[model samples]
Target: MTATVAAPDKTRRLVFPFTAIVGQAEMKLALLLNVIDPKIGGVMIMGDRGTGKSTTIRALADLLPEIDVVAGDPFNSDPQDPELMSDEIREQIAQDLPITITQKKVPMVDLPLGATEDRVCGTIDIEKALSEGVKAFEPGLLAKANRGILYVDEVNLLDDHLVDVLLDSAASGWNTVEREGISIRHPARFVLVGSGNPEEGELRPQLLDRFGMHAEIHTVKEPNLRVQIVEQRAAFDQEPQLFSQKYQQEQIELQEQLIQAQKVLPEVYLDYELRLKISQVCSELDVDGLRGDIVTNRAAKALAAFEYRAVVTVDDIRRVITLCLRHRLRKDPLESIDSGYKVQKVFDRVFGLES
Candidate 1:
């Protein structure tokens, strides 16, 4: 919980540092874990206004190490991974053509509230394809978001159909757009982060369940913390470069930590008993699908990896289970128990952690 700041780059717009942001630990942790392992799916964050949701997310994107992409590629195609490469890049490889590699900051795409299906998913230019005898496709937000973070602010207000399309692409890791019998497919893998105020209305449980984790944040209740957050923001605004330099070392350390965690994630191990108990909690809670269990396991392993541990512990599961399963729980009109509390209660019983 050290206060860390991003190094000031005179050429780039300044963002409030990730570690420098005060409070909202759950939101921050969920985002970090997603970064460590995008296959855990994405995070759905519900919080009040002015909760620093957008700021924290942007800071995280800025905090990440730059990625190697094929030079001049529109999809931000990974130079080494064929699965992450665009069709053009892959075709070049097939033809044994030279490929240039370039480094770029991780892409962060914001899905605007009024975006159309074509805008979010991109469109196939059938006229150009038929006339030129080539599959001419115009990439959209999803294409730009590949191998990055796709953020949707006020996601609950988004059209349900659009949400479905986003979730599908996120889950499948590819987007296929078709028009006039011409189909275009490309990598669309990203850590989907959605934040909205609860008062705006909630995503349908079916759709909500698709997210890997759900984090709920509230306004800081302590007066001192609130004052501190306000002061930090003011200071950041007053002399952004000077303020950022203060915590630049911490930011670099955190960035290295994240990169190391990603490298270590594959070696992290989850115990069989812990896995059983995780599913037991999911089953006992009557969670609809295997996503809850799968996400909890992945999240726990990611947490262990982040802590530089090769083995997952009960504490790791304890830390992430609520975020992994709370939103997936079935809502009963008569039940007064909080979703997080209910998930924890079952976890304690199943994992034998009751005191």
Candidate 2:
């Protein structure tokens, strides 16, 4: 089998700054939360075309701080994360050899719509096998996405089998390839960001449930906000570098905040009472399983950390409850109510609006 990786667009020398995006606060927050605590699983962004879904994702990807990676490692394996490193790398570390370390742009790999399983997951190198009579593995998109974001546009339209593979890898934090009588496994942990148009197709329940948060966005209706978005795009189109330079300071500050949030995340505490409250809200919403409650707890803590707070609060839980449970709730065929509205109703009933 043969495959190719999605290369970054070189034309985009300066991505539209994340701080410059005019609207879609929920989408921005969900991305930021995942960055702070990748254990929050990933985010699913559902909206119509031209809703800034892709733009925001790419901008956020460019906004992130660069990461230190083990040089010559295809997976961007962290030197400290032994479990995620290959045996050869560990041996080099053990030998105290002159280990070359390098800084690399955090990976933001794209999963094109028609990509095959061999492209998403690694495959055997046929050329090396034929030339040298050796079995060698060529890493794919999943490997490239390690310790970074794997973006899938129009995710709902992807092949079901491919979706299953992606879901399994996201949940297990590893991808194992058994091709051409050769077996290989490596850490595939990544923050999965998927954007799709619900009008085209619906995502499978299993895959939907795996997403820690879901943000539903719509076109900006406010005339002024729409104008601001247009003006920004026009400026970006006219002079990408100049437009980026205008927001460089804000971008730097935002990056610093993300770094600080990661440092504070471990110290943020979630108490039992709040945990129980989160469960109560999930239970009231009739969420299918425990994942809703668990995700809410995790997202809340991450939100607090993003705010530089040491303790989780009722407000923190409320802020994230919608994103955590909106996609996980069991839908009522007879009811026309919005899922987000239903989540808010449950929140109000369980904890009250004032609380």
On lDDT, the leading prediction is 1
lDDT tens digits by residue: candidate 1, 154-225: 999999999999999999999999888888999999999999999989999999999999999999999999
Each prediction's TM-score versus the true structure? 0.97, 0.93
Candidate 2 displacement at residue 77 in angstroms:
1.4
Pick by TM-score: which candidate is best? Answer: 1
Pairs of colliding residues, candidate 2: none
| lDDT score for candidate 2 against the true structure | 0.87
What does candidate 2's lDDT look like per residue over 1-355, in tens digits? 1122333335646788999999899999999999999888899999989998988998988999878677778988877778677666777878876556667778999999999999999898877877898768888999999989999999999998998898788878889988666677888888999999999988988889988899999999999998989998999999989999999999999999999999999999999987887898887777887989888888999999888899999899888999999999876789899999888888887776745
Question: Clashing residue pairs in candidate 1, if any?
Answer: none
Worst 10 residues of 2 by lDDT: 1-10
